[model samples]
Target: MGTEFLNIKDSVDAKNLIQEYFNKYYEPEGEEIPIEDSNGRVVFEDIYAKIDFPPFDRALKDGFAIKSEDSFGASEENPKVLKVIDALEAGSYSKKTVENGLAVEISTGSPLPEGADSVLMFEYSLKNGDEVELYTSVTPTQDVGKKGSDVKEGNLLIKKGTVLSASKIGVLAAQGFTTVKVYKKPNISIISTGNELTELGEELKPSKIYDVNSYMIKNAAESIGASGTIKGIVKDDYNQLKSKILECLEEYDILICSGGTSAGVGDVLKHVLDEIGEVKLHGIAVQPGKPTILGVIGEKLVIGLPGNPVSSLVIFNVFVAPAIRSLLGLKESSLKKVEGKLTKRIHSAIGREQYQLVKYDDGKVEPIFKDSGAIFSLARADGYVNVSKNTELVEEGEIVEVNLFN
Candidate 1:
């Protein structure tokens, strides 16, 4: 056997380890779906606009669209005078055109009359007998939102692989897109294995506890723009777990297993992966989620997350979610993050990079626990503070960027 590196490197190494496996198996599969239900789904192709967003020159503020030169150098002392030829309200297209020395009374978002070059705010003008007087100087293109200014015709509005959100939906609507082609939600099967596990939403019986990691990670999958289903629980029996995982492997683009990823006895996930395909990675240099497994099952991406709820969520959020995006169709912008300050001291074991849950209040982040069962840690956290591998402790008042879960 070739010599092996005993020490796990860092988070980058951990990410790169799984990324290589994801690159091969998570390539986009063909699918078509509707735009309404496509929220959170990845775009399969570039979205082109057939027309501009506004589609016309519209007034931004409640003002009168007038020729810019008409109000040139108008002031309180010497006000410019022009006729108010027509009034336009929001949602109404202007039919009357502004003649020389004329102004068109326009409301917010109302289309500008032809020959109008600028808008005079309502506060800056006074109307008297079919004429308006401007009390303030106005520059060219002052208040007119020009046609095709927001987005032009034939412009690329959204690129392929962008996870659709409310803003994206609005953009699509502006482009007159009724339906769009998107990558179908990659059906994911999550199998939790361990004799110590009980079904979620069930009362615990004897030594078995609730399958906390299953739902925690499954919910994380949905939160970060992916669809996943719990394939239920299985005891630490090799054949039983293998059969169930095989069934899940056939239909799902991604397979996630919890509880049996470690090297301990009855660690069935490693064996099931070894039986069907190669185990690409065994361990990572990360606290709580060190026992992360990345591999391929047929042409699908498979991840065996550590059974701890926090561990499962950490691995799934930082690693698995990105893989789902990269393999399917999405960009890094979909993931949300914000920088924060550490309010308290935090210590970590050497060699393993740690993602510590932190609550931010008053410009400070309070440290959360590394224990796997601290679901409250995730719930209350503003985001996570990264623990560098070289550092053993993070001091208070240290500025650290946090990647928010929400």
Candidate 2:
């Protein structure tokens, strides 16, 4: 008898869907030159140290190099005197060999002489005639830094797909890398849809709102070091929406259309994506964003986010943010999610995941307005709290992880 495969629908969580969608698409990747150019770019290659840091052993102090045994038992009460056979300046290499009871004068960063194993501070000893007196005892390897102490040659510095930072550049430079290779930055495109919307500078008519999605989304793209181009506003017509998205998709790796995912406005944006390519997932069981659409547009990406500013940003933070990071080839972002106490109880229905927009103040989180459409509420927010479907209605004083915007 043949067994039937169990069709487990809804078993795949948001994470699983995210992973499945991620595995299907290979983001745009390329190589870039220069250290600063690699800042937002992802590491395409594992970077190894070509040479050891501090390549050579040098004097750690502007003092005299001497044998450790020569300064043994020397103290402030009774000082030991050794002849300063020769003096070496900074950047100079000392060839003199310090035998027993002999000291070689050396400056900071100067290479240690052939036989010297320690250095004595200038303050502890006085130089008179041709010799210097040491008042302190010295230990083996005292005041001497060893080569490769900071880093070793051939050691892995940064793995591929790691976004290089300022300090990362310093490490590469230390490894003698004047030029570093990294993935090229992705080009982002932003478009807003709504017949009742006008541009920012235009006069706001009574029932119509100005186009805020384009500016806001473009700013978000710029924040991540992404190059953004506003494709202007597309009327809530399916044909126009289709034409605009398809046209902009050609010039950008990621195309974003905001405000038309809802059912009321004919959902021209959502339909455009479906007609062009397969919509991976239509509705997410999440709050602040339910009509979210994630789809593949040929080799590019087209996302249909909610029209509400707060809802759109919430979805961006939850889903699109990681996608952007993946596209940039950045390492796992070090964005810390902080836990804060809830100021009041929040009731949410069981079934859909909820991302509550809350303002953190004095170690507490306060929910925003009833709806996530309020833009001003979002502006004042610090982060969000993710409430699972099965577990809703958080009591006051309960601690929750808050994703800080900063």
Candidate 3:
């Protein structure tokens, strides 16, 4: 064992360093993709409505289009009668206009004919021969979908940097958009380092474990809209690690590696980073992830996570996830958090910020304290609560914010 970290930074300072570096160098470009594939993608530019929704006045129900005055004083006892001039269905326009005492039979979504200001629903009118007897009165525009009522022309529909959802895509489809301009997804390469790690599905040799960090970290990046490619596992050999990282940097926007980040005889990731690129940060003052590393090579960013599975994911969520989101032009505040009361008291290292894993259930948060290397700790946890460095203990029944994994 060796003292690997000489100078450690607080978690807040570490986050600021990442933000400052990415803000200066990373500027994502936009690409046009089919609208059907735009969901969950970030918008590169503001999208405006080119035309009005409903383009023209249309019927909101299967009914008759008529002047509102023509239905005045209409009731079950004393009904008003109007001659049906023409019948209109959706996508068809009627050239005929409604005059006084005249109505046009209209189907739902059909464009309202000229000289009509209201629609009488079929339930309120009885068709007798070519005339409809109205049993109820209506006001102008009643049961009528007016032009530009839902969306007006030239209105800003989607703002830049907004993530497209199903509803937003529907709005674009309504405007006849077959494709949309979205920020290109950032490509990230995920690597796991350790001689004790073996590839999944391979026969597990004695004293070796299957590689978990590569698959775990890859999915985490992809969940946030970045394209992830797993580069498999690398041993503790410095030259091999350096060659792999350099190759990945040539093509990927970011490279993330887990394991072999701590200061030990077998930990060679720091030495490789020092020779190939500038190490911006060597350690962070956070529990379960103090040996986290951040670096930059050329224009691409590099991150090293702890060997411990729990520590690796916690640091990724706190530090790497935001960087990925920034490069994709998405909001950094995407993690969902909820408030809950602690089920029991908890203690932490006074000088280090602690991310205490907890199982949140119906506003109650129960601490799940397991060793950092324990992968099951993360599986049992719904989220974690950030305990400040200055605070050493949190009493039971105290309220805290839990950052959810999903």
Q: Pick the candidate with the highest TM-score.
A: 3
Top lDDT model: 3
Predicted candidate 1 versus true structure: per-residue lDDT over 252-340, tens digit per residue: 77889887877677677777777888777778888878888876777776788888778888788887788776755666675666666
Write candidate 3's Cα lDDT for 168-220 as tens digits: 99999999999999988888899999999999999999999989889889888
lDDT of each: 0.79, 0.77, 0.90
TM-score computed on alpha carbons, candidate 3: 0.96
Error of 3 at 363 (Å): 1.1
Give TM per candidate.
0.75, 0.86, 0.96
Q: What is candidate 2's lDDT per residue for 321-342, written digit by digit as tens? A: 6666666665345665777889
The list of candidate 1 runs beyond 4 A from truth reads 1-11, 29-45, 52-151, 159-168, 181-184, 328-344, 373-383
